[model samples]
Target: MSKKSRPGSRSRALVAATAVVVTLLTGAVGAGAAPATTAQRARPTVILVHGALTDASVWRHEVEALQRKGYAVLAPAMPLRGLASDSAYLAAFLKTVSGPIVLAGHSYAGAVITRAAEGDPRVRALVYVTAFQPDTGETAGELNARFPGSRLGPDTTVVLEHPGGSELYLRQQDFRDVYAGDLSPSTAALMAATQRPVETAALGEPLQGRPAWRDTPSWALVATKDNSLPVATQRFMTARAHSRTTEVASSHAAPVSHPAEVTGLLLDAIRGTAY
Candidate 1:
């Protein structure tokens, strides 16, 4: 994970969806049909999934925080091009986790986790941090169209704000008012310089089956000041999926703004859903 002043979303790409038997970090969430005793035991494996255009590095702080709290975590790298590619990758990853598992994702990756959760019984819970939690048979594109005035994504090819800005790409100074209103000028500039460009096709693809969230105990972190994915859209998705909710006054980049809070929620989900 890059240090402070790093640009863009640092996300570990979700490679595949295989059931992975993992060890618990704090609570007794391991091996079986949901656990009978629900006291804090050991931290289970924490799998972090990244959104489009970004890589696995976005989860740096949360990953470290989870580990410090005692979780054997894994954040898979994903194929940013489309949902099917990411889903297949996640499916393969979960199959190997032997015990209770907490699968989490941000932004577009939320849909990826949703698609992979079905049929795979190993996944104990989910965390959607400012992400898109898709419903049964609905495509990401369909959800984008739901807002009427506000689509889930931007149409133009997300371009780089500067020539030498690494991979960070977004509208100039937009985060100031929308996503990262609380951030300083320097911080916002850093995010802009490192922003990754999400593949255009990733947004339009829809879910083909039931979302994994329906059966899984789910938690969501909504960025109230987001400019990228509308806050209303996130609310709609959460309500439609019937997930446990938490709100933060950040931007679309909640992990970046509030890594501590994100990690804490993830821990709670893993411990509570420990089986």
Candidate 2:
């Protein structure tokens, strides 16, 4: 008779075969797992900064939409003081973020981010939403003065009057017309009631350093119907900054009224900018 195999030997051979098969399967699965792409690995945290006459609450819709898309978002309450102070505050805040940042600004906050991002490598991109993109020596007030479509001048009132500086707010009656014309009446009324006043000194404060836009990739949204910052001014600034541009038929409150459009531009910046 052919030499019969021992029972223990046969069992050991079967176990060895099963172990080899399992090892090969595990290796195949591990090899097939793809590494994260540059786009996935480089998604920077987005920091949204609100401008004069508005607080962080104004970005509610945008915050919701960005969060839904799995983007890390922060809408920080900006102290609308002098530009230097505001920019310093933002620069300090940026230190708290763990990774790369996409800094976005609305209205006057644009100037703040411009200065804040200067020499800061962490800020990968800048987004301007109907915002004031001031050059090194330029001021928001000067930019607004250049284009005259804004009705904000008449709506403003002095909150803390002083020879050196003053705080200003949009009159409740004119807030809807000037700032939130496209919003529902009730919504406009609420925004008007809760509007934050900004320092006149802030508007006049000259930028301290070279604009971040000069070095950083930028995206801009021109609200065609914006009465606060004229669409022409928006176009001029975006062109000057060499930024990727998008236009929407909305008021200065685009974040609130046309949140989808605003969010789309921000996503574009996030995707286009490399980490």
Candidate 3:
């Protein structure tokens, strides 16, 4: 991975706190019975949350892909290693938008968006691009640890962690073979090489408050071939969140390798919500 010098440790920690806010600990009712939207409204603000080991740039393909579809996109930078920081930063960013926002996240970021959406009226919908959707008080680790499946993530480095939990970075094979296997050699190499280090502890902690997916009008794009989060685990979370769902036959990094399909789904999300 491209070793871009990460932000200063102190600045990153403060930013982390800023990104985290009051969390909701309950699950809201599913948005299954709402009336269909009728009017053509302002373009919805699309928020893109990226997975572990990646920075905002991972959504480059997605942000551009959605822009061409006539939507205003907000691909905020997230601290992959901090939960409260990532969630709080995202929540604060959502407050600045004017109208409906369609929140989207990939991989572990799915957990971030799930926490960021509580009681925020600006969010009109949610889209999980092969992301995680843990319930209130459920940590990403506990969520990912559910019996039926396993995480397709890689092993931790000894220098990073000594005994137990350490951020498990993705291997080239995970990205090139199972996640974004369909991408060209050149593009895949760039993405793989540019992967970032994540906060190992973020995976083990449960959400502090109510989960946003319970009541939000959410949609899920399941990359069936995803080995990173375990395809079954993705399905498990999607089902629990009770979201409108679509299937993409790619791997974990569908947003990068399958931008066309990923953005196409985003277009459908906009039209479905009338914003």
Which sections of candidate 2 miss by over 4 Å?
Answer: 1-42, 154-156, 162-165
How are the candidates ranked when ordered by TM-score, highest leading?
2, 3, 1
Candidate 3's residue-wise lDDT over 1-275, tens digit each? Answer: 87665569768887776656322212121232232332236678888888887778877877887777676888877877667777888888888887778888888888888888888977888888888888777787776666444444444221166464465566665556645666787877787788776778887767878888777778889887765667787778878878778888886778877888888777777778745
Of models 1 and 2, which has the larger TM-score?
Answer: 2
Q: Please, what are the lDDT tens digits per residue for candidate 1 over residues 1-275?
A: 96664333323222221112222422344434245343334346779998864568779899888787767888887866678877888888888776667889998899999998887767888999989888766776566556653322344234444443322234655644444556678877676666666656567777878888888889999877776677788889888777888888877778878898898789778767856
Rank order (by lDDT, best first): 2, 3, 1
Q: Count the backbone clashes (under 3 Å) in each candidate.
A: 62, 0, 18
Give the worst 10-residue stretch by lDDT in candidate 1.
12-21
Model 1 scores a TM of 0.74
TM-scores, all candidates, are: 0.74, 0.84, 0.77
Model 3 sits at a Cα RMSD from the real structure of 22.1
**Per-candidate local distance difference test:** 0.74, 0.90, 0.75
**Between candidates 2 and 3, which one is better according to lDDT?**
2
Candidate 1: deviation at residue 53, Å?
A: 3.2
Q: What value of lDDT does candidate 1 attain over all alpha carbons?
A: 0.74
